[model samples]
Target: MGSVFHGDITVGYEDEGSGEALVLVHGHPFDRSMWHPQTEHFSRAGWRVIAPDLRGYGDSTAVPGTTPLAAFARDLAGLLDHLGIERCVLGGLSMGGQIVMECYRLFPERIRGLVFADTFASAETADGKAARYAMAERLLREGMDGYAHEVLAKMISPATIAARPDVAAHVLRMMTATPPEGAAAALRGRAERPDYTGLLSRVTVPALVVVGAEDAYTPVGDALDIHERVPDSRLTVIEQAAHMPNLEQPDTFNAALGAFLDALP
Candidate 1:
């Protein structure tokens, strides 16, 4: 279902279905496999599903720089071009969201739709970004385990993590596996990223906004903010879920995401 290939360094991705092409991008500390539910459902619904493990994360090579998002965007665009896709729907979670924004900016004409799940356009600016960068640097240098544990606690709802140790462990392992430098650099880039609030207002494409009701990282409030800014953007909040609503409430998440893709023109 998936293969590892070179794109700004060797990267891996999974492809499925056979209709309108839709690309799924995973967040940091995880691989494309994270989109299992949504991708499966959308594929069955008749849309081509493409999920790629961005460079420097998952089983791929690491990108050493401050602007990894640019490379990530290029990878998505290149993948589509390589597949001979004239246009495609762009979807992402967290860092994946950042990548989509960059991709849209870089290749606006190729984007047919937008899906943002548990993510937001950058909010920090200037010196405020410095603090976030410093925090990431500290974590990279000496806080991998602790950072992983902290992320685990916040990423999944307390009930989910407490009920499923296996899932919790898998997520933590992914977070821990992220190259510290890569993670730090990626975070720093996101922290200092340009405000896309203005960009959202200009988005002529239909958009889908989804988030975990209990997501502490990018909560429902953040999702609402995006919904308000983007034109014709529909918002869906998945209950009993945290940052990873897709993993925690797969059925609901899949249903909502599939509906969005299906409704797309």
Candidate 2:
């Protein structure tokens, strides 16, 4: 674990291995630790893996006020600059995928490739926005205690919960540990993210889209839509997994990711 000061905020990150860089962003309510499997795997395969706790999630600074989703992207750009990386493949899961899209919008030149995992490319619908706002309010009012368990079924497959108690426990711990303010800020910010459908059509780099076969949040159809729009992209679906496939099925997720990284220019 290391720390870099991106302006006033101190972004906590884990940097490992060497060679080509691969920056993996964690999803909503989860910290950089969520990428432990990918970080170790890819780093061992001769890639520099950097995973950061987006401001509010991990040890990173929390937002005192509402923060735009783009702020997370800007923080990423700053982290790359801090590391003197000119360009690299950028990957994100769930909300992290949205952040990667924002990063591509703001610093296209800095992104050599893209990876979208269990995520979507559309803006939040009117109903979705309302739901997000409601969630934010609920988190603020009740915190993450029971709320983490409430969403665990949707985040991971039923098989995982029944067969892998350790994994289930880890996911719950990550979610429950998240600060309410940070989670709320992220929820509100995500509600306002721009539609990335048009942006996907313009992606020229080698792209990989991976989704759990049973992801309820984004769903397989959403991943297909993204794959259809992005010209140079391949899609992989990990069976028996849900939203967090990388955690639930690390070996399969890493296999798909490894092939993508190997084929990159």
Candidate 3:
């Protein structure tokens, strides 16, 4: 684990392995630890794997004010610059996927390929925005205990929770440990993110879109939309998984990701 200073915010990340660079971004409320499965696998397979805790999560500094998703994108770009990586494959899950799209919008030349997992390109609807704000308020008042329980079923399949108690517990711990201020800021900021459907059609690089078959938030349909719109893209659906397929079904997810990396120039 290492730390980098990006203005007032300090970002924490894990850097491992060697060869072609591959940066993996974690989703909202979770930290870089979530990518342990992919990081170790890909690094051993001859690729540099970087997993960073976003500004408000894990060991990174927390911002009190509203943090636009674009801010997260810029932090990623800065991290690449700090490491002297001119261009590398960028992969992200959930909110991290949205952040990758924002990075593409800001610095397309810096991306070699894209891995979008369990995410969508559409903007938040009115109802969705309202819900996010409501959640934010609830978190500020009540903390993460209730929210963690509410989201657990939607995050992983029932079979996963039953079969892998450790993984389920890890997920809960990650959520509960997240700073309320930071999580709330993210929720509010996400409400203002731009629609990336148009951007998806413009992506020309090799892209892989993966989703859990049972993903409730961004379903398989969302992955198909991304694959169909992106000029050079493939879609893979992991069975018996939900939102966090990479964690729920690591072997399958890593296999698909490895194939994508191998195909990339």
Candidate 4:
């Protein structure tokens, strides 16, 4: 684990292997450890993998209050600048995917390709915004343990929880261990996310849209929408997996990602 300071924030990251860069962002309520499988697999496949724990998660500095999506994007851009990487294949899952879209919005020239996994391209609905705000208040009031237990099944499928105890435990650990202040800040920021449908249509780089067939959060339909909107993109849906397919079915997810990376220019 290496870290780079961005003013008051210390971004904790993993930098491994060599060759073209592939920067993977972890989703909300989770840390960089969530991408351990991908880091090992892709780094061995001759790619430099950079996975970072967002400001409020993992070993990074925690800041109370809102952490806008653009803040996350700027942190990543700053990390790349520190590493002297001008470009990379940027990818993310869930809220991380939305952050990647914001990255593209701010720094298109720094991206060689795009990967959107188990995520959506729409803005938060009025109902979603309300729920997010409510959840933020709940996190601040009650802390993350209760929310982690409640959302564990939703984050991964029931089948996954039953069949893959290890993945289930890991996912639960990430959520429960997350700081309430940080998680609540992220929730507040996410509540105001803008629609990325128009932005997707303008993406010129080759793109990969992946989702779990059983993902209840984003669903396969969300991936399909992204694939259709992105002029040059590929879509892959992993079976027997849910929102966290990369952990629940790492082999299948890695195969799709590997193929996409190999095909990229």
Highest lDDT against the true fold, candidate: 4
Give the alpha carbon lDDT tens digit for every residue of 110-228 in model 1: 99999899998856767868877886778667957777887787888998888877778778877877777667767777776777788888898999999999998898898999999
**Whole-model Cα lDDT per candidate?**
0.81, 0.93, 0.93, 0.94
Expressed as tens digits, the lDDT of each residue in 70-112 for candidate 4 is: 9999999999999999999999999999999999999999999
Q: Candidate 1: where are CA atoms >4 Å away?
A: 1-8, 126-128
Candidate 3 regions exceeding 4 Å error are none
State in Å the error of residue 212, model 2: 0.5
Per-candidate clashes, comma-separated: 2, 0, 0, 0
**Model 2 lDDT vs. the true structure?**
0.93
Candidate 3 residue 222 Cα shift, in angstroms, is 0.8
Candidate 1 lDDT score relative to the true structure: 0.81
lDDT of 3 by residue, 9-32 (tens): 899999999988999999988999
Task: Report the poorest 10 consecutive residues by lDDT, candidate 2.
Answer: 61-70
| Candidate 1 TM-score versus the reference | 0.91
Candidate 2 lDDT over 59-121, as tens digits, reads: 999875566778999999899999988999999999999999999999899999999999999
Greater-lDDT candidate between 1 and 2: 2
Give candidate 4's error at residue 166 in angstroms: 0.9
TM-score of 2: 0.98
